[model samples]
Target: MPTATPSPDFVAALREYQPLVRRVCRLYCQDADDRQDLFQEIVLQLWRAWPRYVPQPDAKLSTWLYRIALNVAISNLRQRTRRPARVGLDDDAARSLAQPTESSAYEPEEMAALYAAINRLSDVDKAFVLLYLEDRPYDEMADILGITQNNVRVKMHRVQERLRRLLVPASTH
Candidate 1:
């Protein structure tokens, strides 16, 4: 059977949402090459699923995007072989974690450590962290994760506690 081409509307939507897709890629992937591969795979899956997409008045586009992106990332993570754990930072790592000029939140080292801790989380926990960092509503997070809102709330709290343990100083603990 011949394959269906993606519609123009789908193409336009993907273009507009590409940054969101890339952000998902960044959250899940460590290396630049891996990030690119994940990005391409996500776009492929999104294109394949585009025909089935039905716009609902109550649903936001980002909800669908998050669902697809997280599912693909988790699946990809499962399929990959494990690599040696990395320790210490390099120039590339520092560059990637660089903060915007307008922001004076966490220092670069703190940001890198936070990201490293996030990377250590299970795929499901990482999804919770990603949605929380994005400031997604519990309802939308539950919908994207296909869990009850209360479950999302519970999981999110646990994930926050885990991150605190990972990022906080021992003296503060």
Candidate 2:
């Protein structure tokens, strides 16, 4: 099938915001293959939805970009059954992650533990965690989830508590 060439504006918008989509994909899909598939799906959905994108006078483009990317990443359910039984971390990737780079915030083992807990969260909770981790404003988080701002604040607090519970050692709790 011949692929429709993206409009110049579409091309520019996509190129400028791909990293945002990639980050969402990485958060949602642990397997590299699933990550690439989700990335492609997000791009396809964005391309299909481009005609409706009205550039408001004062709105930030990244906000709209995040909305669409999160929508796609959160809604996709077809690949759940196809997920591999075990996803192995590449040795080189693990080695690089362990190395203390200039910007390293946590040890790789801590990061791995964090990811393990995150993976165990429910899908909705995972969405909440993603937004919280990104430090999205309450209003924006509410808009993304179609909830009130107060509700978002409440839910955000609950989500954090849940994550804390998950991360706390069983013996300490």
Candidate 3:
């Protein structure tokens, strides 16, 4: 019997894919500790599935990795039980987790408000927001989410409207 060595390309692929999981986890998890844990979980899942990754000529490797990472992050059942203490803006601990932006206009409060609104959204809607914020095209977003582009547009519009309504004070309602 002949033994085959693991390819170096697999190691490189894992390294390249790590950031996608990290970013998605950061968006989904509000606290540093929870985000780190989620990242670890996602990586573990990815590593487990890596050997079975057969490449298709038509599809990009990054997209395939992204789908797996997003699926793992979005459908993670463990998150329900181990909810992060610093969810959205209310928790004082959330401040430290904010990513720095080059522009001065970036405000943690606004991000907190957005996240607070997002928390009220359904899981599917949260995926829409995450993809939208990542600047993905409607076609790609639709493909990743398993919906038509038109439906994605319509749902995205509704999601934004709902988020806006959530941000408004009760007095305005």
Candidate 4:
């Protein structure tokens, strides 16, 4: 069957929110290749869903995008973990990994530490972190996450505390 061409509106939305998708991928995937693959998967999923996406005035486009991206990332992670883990990468791959995927929000060292801590989090908590980092409003986060606003607030607090403990050294605590 012939594929439907993407609508101009879908193209526009993807262009505008491409960074958001990258951010989601960065938060979820540690490997450079995995990040890129996840990004492509996200874009494909977004394109496939675009026709059914009716923008509700109350729910922003980014929220819907987040919902799809996070679901894909979490599902992908689950599938990946079921397989045997890969060993160390080649020198070139390591060098590529050493480079920042995107302009980081924190300093290099701080970003490294923060990402390390975040890596330890559950996928759901990582979603919370992504939304928090994006400066999304709680209502929007809840909407994107398909949870109650109060659940979002509570989970966010717990996730923050978890991240804080993860970041703090035992000697300093």
Give each model a TM-score: 0.87, 0.82, 0.79, 0.87
Model 3 Cα lDDT, one tens digit per residue, 1-173? 11154357766887776767777886676666767887877767666676787888766677667687778877773465476454345465445544446763668877666667786777778888878987888887877777899999999999999888898989986
TM-score: the better of candidates 1 and 2: 1
- Per-residue lDDT for 41-150 in model 4, tens only? 99999888887888797888889999999999999989889998653344454444345547655555565667777878999999999999899999999999999999
| Clashes in predicted model 3 | 0
Prediction 4 TM-score vs. true: 0.87
RMSD over all Cα atoms, model 4: 3.2
Q: After superposition, how far is residue 53 of candidate 3 from its true place, in Å?
A: 2.0
**Local distance difference test scores for all models:** 0.85, 0.75, 0.73, 0.85
For candidate 1, write residues 57-140 as lDDT tens digits.
Answer: 988988999999999999988777465544434567655855544654777777788887887788999999989988899999
- Indicate the TM-score of model 2: 0.82
> Which lDDT tens digits does candidate 2 get at residues 114-154?
76677667767777888787788888777777789999889
Residue ranges of candidate 3 with Cα displaced over 4 Å: 1-7, 77-79, 82-90, 97-99
Q: Which stretches of candidate 1 lie over 4 Å from their true place?
A: 1-5, 82-91, 99-104, 170-173
